[model samples]
Target: MEQIVQAECCGKTITISTGKIAKQASGAVMIKSGDTMVLVTAVAMKTAKEGQGFFPLTVNYQEKAYAGGRIPGSFFKREGRPSDNETLTCRLIDRPIRPLFPEGFLNDTQVMATVVSADKDNDPAILSMIGASAALMVSDCPFAGPIAGVKVGRVDGKFVANPTAEELEKSDLEIVIAASQEAILMVEGSAAEVSEDDLLEAIFFGHAAVQPILAAQLELAKKVGNPKRDIPAPVVNEALKARVAALAKEGMKQAVRIKTKVERHLAIDAIRDEAIAALVPEFEGSEKEVKGFIEDLEYDLVREHIIKDGERIDGRDTKTIRAIATEVGLLPRAHGSALFTRGETQSIVAATLGTSVDEQRIDSLYGDSRKKFMLHYNFPPYSVGETSFRLAPGRREIGHGMLAERALQQVLPKHDDFPYTIRIVSDITESNGSSSMATVCGGALSMMDAGIPIKAPVAGIAMGLIKEGDDFAILSDILGDEDHLGDMDFKVAGTAEGVTALQMDIKIGGVTREIMAAALAQAKDGRIHILGEMAKSIAAPRADLSAFAPRITTI
Candidate 1:
């Protein structure tokens, strides 16, 4: 028997169905919104790969031009490589689900989410995750899923779930969160210097709204779910583990105690090298086993410190933000600019106002799209105090920039209200903690410095967690060292009234609501403090934009 359910998120009705299409796959579902529809299919190989240790799960998100009643623009007249936006959507779909799969299931699995229709106003990323989860729940694949995703925006200090693209433009905070029934799985967003408390509240708002979506998937699963497949678990050698632990115990402790990111990483590398060299003589045939032992030992040391002492490697309190400093109009030539520093991280953000022609044109399978607000993040070798040959922004840079862009999106004026293309560039001059959040803070100041009539100023802060067994410590405005040794990275951005953007990534297992709640509460205090410091530099936006910036009059 097939099941279909529909619910409203933001202003759109999301309909999900399973057991009616692609029945041959382990699990499959069709999701629809307005005239736009997407088909998500999940398939897992019966047998695990010989050497593949990680869960071989792949997520593909494709947007067909025909979905929007448009044809391809290229001479070939067909889709080519995935666009940057599509790649990002795929990442979004993958991150939340990848962590939720049951441990020890190493089967080669694939989750494909294809958009057959698009309304332009409603993004397909969140919908795709819903469909993917539904498909997985009903499939024979062994997945610990039933996750749902939603986009939260802040408008006039109120939180809106699944906000429309139009509403987001006017909001000061834009956050996307994916959650399971009990805990949040992933978060990604940008903010306009909202309070930490508001950000936490918004996350709860999103999580609560997503509960219905998860219920819908479960309902469908119970109706047509296939029997889950059985797979054998990987084994660890007790003898080899004991030897490796004895050799690496002392070195791993020292590695976790190092405060600076560079120093800690260097210490870890040296320890691993020494361990490998020592093992080459004792265990000539078990080099791989020896290497794995060293890694696990290092992780154990870091996790134990957090769980036992409630202390971070850099020695910070759970609710403390790093040292922060703000400087506005740092560059004379730029229309508006601000250099924001948090702990060791620093971002020089500049705002440029352009005419309509200056707007960015995005070409994708959907069609040609123009964006009035743009945020670009650049990471140079100097930021990390290292040297690299790569010249252009890599995937990480693009992804970070997009995250910050979404955070501040909620505060941007409506197109009709302020008709100018606003571009924000965040040049990472130094990085030790959260550069993207710094970008959000600097971007807000830069926009105001340029005299853009933003609804409010937005700020962002990165939160970290060190967990071992049941013991854990949540750190606010974390430094790079804490991030590296931490198990969870929970970032929240927003204003005094509500949250705008949030993103969380967990390395071990998922967290509980209690932990998430505590983290949010601490984050609120840090966010408010950061905002107070920013106000000292510039309280509100200037009345007029810089003379050098282009002026646009809406017709």
Candidate 2:
């Protein structure tokens, strides 16, 4: 069935049509906004792999040269590994839709969105997120989503939904919100010191604007939806579960309260091994099941303690930030280097100044695009005290680096003013929580140390939420444990003036605007405190670049 569903969103026509492309897939949709188009297709494996523990869904978003009327610029003339932009876009589409599936439905589902067309003004990522949702909604998979995504920009004082590039350039905000009619499910964007109240209004306004787009998706699914295949529910051994719970409850509580991250991890491992030693004989060859039960219990214990007892794993108040320290000009030979440490989390961020020759150039359908400012983030396993071998930078590193880049993008001097290419590399040597925010703080310091005349010194902080129906606590400078066990991770970055960047992701189905407002306020305070501590290191940019760095001047 070739069906096209259309809607008017923020003065632009959005068209989602199915049945014409990738017909063999479970579900497929082509979304168009102006000349920008993305073709998203969803596919589910016929059967789950034996002992598949987690949902094996993969979302890949790619940009083809043909989409933007360009050719792939490579020796082989072939597309290879995903670009950082594509990787970040994949995260954008994956995070919101990943949770809407049944917990036990491990159907190796895949959603792939390719930018088949690009209008330079419109971003394909927004369309990709929308297309991914629409494809999954109509797929023969148990996806409880018809989620709609929109880009919210505030220029001057008024909010604009899905604003143009020109508007975004002048806007103080660039927020992307994904919703499910009931509440906001996913949000990731950067702002320019926007207030908590204004950010809240923009969120609500984005929610309202997506209603029609959601309706259009529903209509499209109605016409060309597939018959969902039902995978049998995961069978549970309640008797075995009860026995493990009774045996490990007290021991687990003791393990979670350990002060040090490594000690606590070791204790949990010992407990898991002890539990397995006790249960494996009874349920022979079901060691995986036994281990899974204990892990679930671990999550329950941590989450319940936070929500019920108003307790954090680290024994800090809900709104209390951890002790912070900052240092700059650490590397004598480098252009710029800063060390930002917040409790167990730390970042060694270095900035380099370059000329026009050093600008990162990407040849795509969008034409010869160049960026003067680039940020790279690296997370080695040793940072988290893991001994496992590591691979190349994955989606997390790319996403984190991009977030930090956006956090400081507004404060950067214009190319004409600075006439230099700037690159910031943030290395996570130790991590507990919000290493990306640490990057933001360290990146700013490194830039100043490199003598980039940034408008202001920037800092960032992560705010968490532990909500239990009516009772909720907004946490500041959350630890890794809280992030894993809590309801929300709301990260805000900015200078003394206001918020320059923000990102929020929730485990629960949706969070109210009230919670969002509270998180923003709390994050702002935390950011300010972090900035104050950073001031002890360097108040402003140095008057001169390093002698090692090349001098950049307008010719």
The candidate maximizing TM-score is 2
For candidate 2, write residues 1-555 as lDDT tens digits: 689989898888999998888999988889998899999999998888997888998999899988877778888887877877788889999888877888789868889999888997778998998899899878888888888889999888999999988998888888999999899998889887777788889999999999998998888878874667776778999988998999898999999988688899899999899989998999888799889988888888987887777777877767778889999999998899999999999999999988889989876667778988999999999999777566578889888989999999989997888898888999999999999999999999999999999999889898888877798888999889889878888888888888888888888888998888888888888888888899999989999989999985567
Per-model TM-score versus the true fold: 0.83, 0.96
TM-score of decoy 1: 0.83
Candidate 1 lDDT over 1-555, as tens digits, reads 578887766566789988778888888889987776899999988888786667778888898888888888878989887777887888888888887777788888899998898886676888898888888898887778789998888787788887776888788767778888888788777666556656667877898888878887877777774677775665888887897788888878877788777888798888888877887787677777777788788767766776677666767646667677898989888999999988778889999988888988887645678998999999999888788999687667887888888778888888888988888999999998889889989999998898988888887888888766766778888777667667788777766665667778876556777888788777777777888989989979999878788766656
Task: Name the lDDT value of residue 405 in candidate 1.
Answer: 82
Model 2 misses residue 210 by how many Å? 0.6
Task: Give the 10-residue window scoring lowest on summed lDDT in candidate 1.
Answer: 190-199
- The lDDT, on a scale of 0 to 1, for candidate 2 is 0.88
What lDDT does candidate 2 reach at residue 472? Answer: 88
